[model samples]
Target: MAVRSWVNAFAVIILSVGQASAESSSGSLASSVKRLTDKFMATGAEGTPPGIPAISVAIGRDGKLLYADGFGQASENRPATAGTIYMVGSITKQFAAAAILRLIEKGATLRHGSTLLKTTTPVSSLLDIANDWTLEGGPPITVAHLLSMTSNLPNFTRRPPHELDPWGAVPAKQLLGGMKEYRPSGYPGSFEYSNTSYFLLSEIMENVEVGGSSRDYHRILREELFTPLGLSDTGFGGDSWEANRLANPHYRRRPRFSQPDWLKGSGDVASSVIDIFKWNKALMEGQALSPQMRDLMLSDCARVDVWTYYGMGWFISHKDGTDRFFHSGTVSGYTSYNLIVRPSPAHWVSVSLLANSDGVEGVDSLADELAELALKS
Candidate 1:
C-alpha cells in the first residue's frame, strides 16, 4: 500500500482527548505521563528495525500543555526537540475539513468557471467528477460525503490504473486526469476509508477557493488555521522547510515526495507536536470551529466497528471510559498520530506523536495506554 493510504487507516485501538488539573499535573501525574512516554520511546517505536530515528510528543490536559518532549536524534548532527518539524501525514485532513467547514459556515465561496459556488455546494456540481463516483442508483456525492469518507468511492492512491507514487512528482493535470473513472467501493452512508475522498475534497477547495489555479494548500492552511493559531512551524514539505531544520525521515530517505502537489491536502502537511497541540486545543475547545460545525465534524461519524467511527477527517472512538477523537497518518518515512481523549466530562486530553520512521509500532497502543492511565489516575 502507498504511504498516503495509511493515514486514517492505521488506528487500531481505542483513544481520544485527555487532561488533568494543573495542581495534580505538576507532581506524580506529570511524572507518570512523562515517564510512560519516555519508556515507550526507550524501545525506539517497538518492533521496527532501523527503528524510529526521532520522535516528538505533545500531551495536553484541560486546555493546558501537560507534557511536551522529544526522543532520539533528528539527524546525525542534531538532536530532535519538541519543535522539530516532521511531515504530519493525514493529520492534514483535519485542517482541510476545518477550512471547508469554516468557509461553509461563513458562506465562503469561490469561482467555478462561469458560476460561483459555496462550500455546501455538491461536489459533482463543483468539480468534473466521474458518473460512477457514486454507487449505482445512489444520489450524487456531496462535499459533506467527501469530507466524512462516506463517499464510498474506490481509492486512487493504491488502486489499479491510478496507483500513485508518493516518492515521485505527479503534475496537477496528470493527477486530475486519473480520477476520470472510479468504481465505487462499500455502500452509501457506511464508513469506508478512502484517501481519494480527501483528494476530491481538496480539489473542491482549490477550484472553489482559488479557482483551481495553482497548488496553494499550504497557503490556504497558513491563512485559515496556521496563521490564526500561531502555528509557525507547520507547512507543506519542501523549500519552505529548510533541509537542516526539518527532521530527516529515517529508514526510507531521499526522493521523499519533494513535490507533494499530487498528495495535495490528503497527506502533505509537516508540523510540530507543539503547534499540532495548539491546533487541537483550539479545535477541541471551540476556537477553530463554531460549536455547530465542531459537532458536525465529530458527530457526523459513521460507525465502522464496535468502537470506531469515521467522522469528517477524524476517527471517533468511544471505549473503555475514553471518549476519543483522533487521526493517524504516514507518507514516505514519517508517521504521525494526534489524539483527543476525554476521561470525564470536565477533563480532556490530547496527545500528538510525530516520528521520523514509517513503522512506529504501538502508536495507537500508546494512546490507549495513556487514556487508561489518565482514567486510573
Candidate 2:
C-alpha cells in the first residue's frame, strides 16, 4: 500500500479497535487504562530492541482531565512523569493552523479594512515559490488546499536518501528556494499528504504581518495559542533547561540526535501530555477560538480516502456516527498521537500519547485502548 494509505489504515485500525471496545465494560476505567499502559510498557522492556525511553499518556473527559501519567524512564536514572516533555511532532500543525486563523480573525477587525484570509486565498500571495511551483498547468494553490493537504507540493523529505537526519537544521527559506526544481505531483485540489505543505504554511505565517510586524511562527503560536491556553510546558524544544526535563529520544535503546531547527511549525514543539490535555480542553470549550473559526478548523475540507477527511491541521473521522478530530506524528525518534471528540452525541473525550521512540510496538494501539477506556468511563 502507498505510505499515506498505510498511515490512514493504521489510524483506522486503532480507532476501530477503540470504538469496538468502548461499549464493553470489562473493569473499572482506571484499571482498564492501567492494564493497557502496562501492555504498552512491556514492549519496551530491557530485552526489546529500540525500547521506548519514556511514554506519557493523558486522558480528558468533558473538558476535565481524567488521568495523566507516565511510564518507563526519561533517562538512565530519572523516572518519567506526567510532566515529562516530548517532541509532539506533527501535532504541532494544529498550533500552526490556529495561529493562522487567529491572524485572519484579527485582520477582520482591523481599522483599515484589511483583507482577511479566506480558504480561496491564493497561496502565492503569501509564499513566494507557489507562483512557479505547478505541474501540467494545474490551478493555483490556495490556503485551504494547504490546510487540507491537497496543495500537491512534493514531499521533500521523502526524496533520495529517505532517512535524512532529523536533528540537522534546514532553513525554511532554503527549503522553499529549492522548490523550483520539483513539480507538483497532483492538481491543487488533489489530496496528497506532504510535510512541505505545512512547512510552506509556516513560512507564510512568518511573512504575514499580524499584530504588528511579522514574528517567528513559534512566537506567534506562543502568543496567540499557548499563552491564552496556559500551555506553559508547550513550546519549541530549544531551551537547555527545559531540555533537561525532556524524555530522551532513542533508537535501539540508545539516544538519538536532537530535532532540527527548521521543524518549527511542522513538528518541533515539545510538550507534556498534561499540557496537551489542557489544550484539548481550551479548544473544545471555545476558549481558544471563536465558534465560527472553530467550525472552520474542524470542518472537513478534503476526502483523504473512504474513511477519513482532512481539515486544517486535523484528520476528521467518524466512529459510530460521531465526529472525531485527531492527528498523529512521527519524527526521527518520537511518536505522538492526539485525539479529541467534541461533546454532543459523542461522549466527549481527549487522549494524548507521546513516546520517546518512533514505531515503538503497540503504542498507537495502546492509545486507542486507553481512549476507549476513558470514553466508557
Error of 2 at 358 (Å): 1.5
**Candidate 2, which ten residues in sequence have the lowest lDDT sum?**
1-10
Q: Where is model 1 more than 4 Å wrong at Cα?
A: 1-34, 42-50, 110-120, 160-166, 210-215, 252-258, 372-377
Judge candidate 1 at residue 209 and give its lDDT: 50
lDDT of 2 by residue, 159-276 (tens): 5123344346555566667665666665557788777777777877777775456677778888899887888778776755344467887764333234454566777788888788
Q: What is the lDDT, from 0 to 100, of the residue 201 in candidate 1?
A: 71
Tens digits of per-residue lDDT, candidate 1, 1-377, equal: 11211211221111213334423433555566667667777654454443777888776767777566577889897777777789898998999888878666654455535444443456766777555455546777777778878778776666723466656787755676677777666656576788888877777666655434433556667787888887777777764565555898775645444465667778888888878888988988889989888888988367878878877889997777767898999888889998988867678878888999875778887776665554444
lDDT of each: 0.71, 0.72
- Badly placed stretches (over 4 Å) of model 2 are 1-27, 44-50, 108-116, 134-138, 160-167, 252-259, 342-346
Q: Each prediction's Cα RMSD?
A: 7.2, 8.4
CA shift of 104, model 2, Å: 0.9
Error of 1 at 53 (Å): 1.0
